[model samples]
Target: MADEKIKKVSIICSKGSLEGVYPALIMANGARMEGIEANLFFTFFGLDAVTKKKVKKIKVATVGNPAMGIPTLIGAIPGMSAMATWMMNKKMDKLDIPPIDEFIEMINAAGGKLYACKASVDMFGLEKDDFMDEVKKILTVGEFYALAAGGHIIFT
Candidate 1:
């Protein structure tokens, strides 16, 4: 019989905004569910997703997005960020989707790897202690490629 092939996937997140952040998280989580060996590498603005100080503060954008005009207008009225974030969380909950933090937890628990880009960490003036405890390592581009090579690489 032929040897079984292992599916590997690497997800690179480079944006900090709410919409930009979720896709990477969701995709990594999905990869784990499929029994794939998944790696999530956070870079640049995407570092916010794993920063302890910013992870819990993630908010939905009510403004700037063309599809969000009405919500943005309503959100600008008063206490909109909180409201929008709450609504977004509620919708996600209804869909049985965990929060980003919990999603990361699930992925890690499933044996997926989480990493932060060293260049981004330096650029953001972040130390190793500043990242989430789940981060398996801080990797340079070369090191990341070593892990990602021969696997599917996705950039979000």
Candidate 2:
């Protein structure tokens, strides 16, 4: 088993925050770059990364984020989340990290597959039209598992 090579990667994104969503995207992108098959599955709040109206507006979660090192009171201030998001974007821009919308396009262009969770779409009352053009399909959990078969599964 230790000698087995990874042939594919199936990454699940289940959070909506900028910080929450990027890890799965980055991993999928990296897997493709390594010549491994890659699939990205967006579910629950993570669907925001693929939703047409919400993609560009995803923000970093300031409240209840322990990694941020800020007190809950401070993080809950009206403008704090926006400020943190802006700062993060600025830093990422300096480092040449693509925004979520552009990142999805890049992954698609590189032959990576993109999917939205069927249950999540229904729960959010979203239609197929609500997703970005890069999303290839809406899949039930079983369907996703089928696609994820023989691949490493990662949830972010």
Candidate 3:
């Protein structure tokens, strides 16, 4: 146990909302900060975080989000999601946290590998050009499993 070492980490980002996405980003960034190899795998709705157009303008999920303390019906009111997203962004800014796009760029520049789920990309009609250039490749589950072997796997 004393000689155990973490050589790599794979963080699976499965949800698209701001809250769903940040945990994976933060963890992958933290892993790299500690000199560990980190891989970020974006799938399904999570693909929003890697898409060039949506990456910088992601919204918080107000509707059906139990953490918000509002009724699901009320949460669906117009502008609720926008307001929540704004509030979260403001809080993060005050805390000196980078915006989503900038954070992704920072992680990429730090050598973190970013990947999109191939099936999702195809199902969603997303071309390679639709994603941020920082995404290294689109991978199927089997490929990801193989690549992530021998290290920790985190699902956020």
Candidate 4:
């Protein structure tokens, strides 16, 4: 592993929530700044991070999140998810973290590639236009793996 130079990184995002998506975006953006080729592939519920409408509003996970200290049942109560999401976003904003759309734009402008999982897109009834304009294409898992060969592959 020490002998290999990391010329590229492919990140797989499988969760849709803000907690899940931001890490992938941060890493991808960081990779490009380091002169490494970066590709972000959004799959399953992670599609929300790439979808034009939902990306900016991706919420924090409240239900089933033990870190929040709320019982799962209580966390699942109406408005709790929104409150958590709002709190997280407020913190992120104060920290100067750009919203998801701006983050994607920055990465794309810096040459990072964005892709959506074809299966997820189909399952969600999303067309190409449903994704952020920066997304290069939608690819199957097999196709994604083939493209991801020869460098580090990270799952977030």
Best by TM-score: 2
What number of clashing residue pairs does each candidate have, in the order they appear?
A: 0, 0, 0, 0
> Candidate 1's error at 72, in angstroms?
6.4
- Residue-wise lDDT of candidate 1 within 1-156, one digit each (tens)? 257665899999998877788999888888888888899999998998889888888877767666766655675776776787888889988998888788778778988899999999999899988888889899999999999998989999
Error of 4 at 134 (Å): 0.6
Candidate 2, residues 1-156, lDDT tens digits: the string is: 898879999999999999999999999999999899999999999999999999999999999999999999999999999999999999998988899999999999999999999999999999999999999999999999999999899999
TM-score, one value per model: 0.88, 0.97, 0.95, 0.92
lDDT of 3 by residue, 1-156 (tens): 868878899999999999999999999999999999999999999999999988977999888888899899999999999999999999998987788889899999999999999999999999999999999999999999999999999998
Better of 2 and 3 by lDDT: 2
The Cα RMSD of model 4 versus the native structure comes to 1.5
User: The CA-based lDDT of model 2 is what?
Assistant: 0.96
Off by over 4 Å in 4: 1-4
TM-score of 1: 0.88
Residues 1-156, candidate 4, lDDT per residue (tens digit)? 688668999999899988889999999999999899999999999899888888867888899889989999999899998999898888988998888889989999999999999998999999999988999999999999998998889999
Candidate 2: Cα lDDT at 43: 98
Candidate number with the higher TM-score (1 or 2):
2
Say which prediction, candidate 1 or candidate 4, comes out ahead on lDDT.
Answer: 4
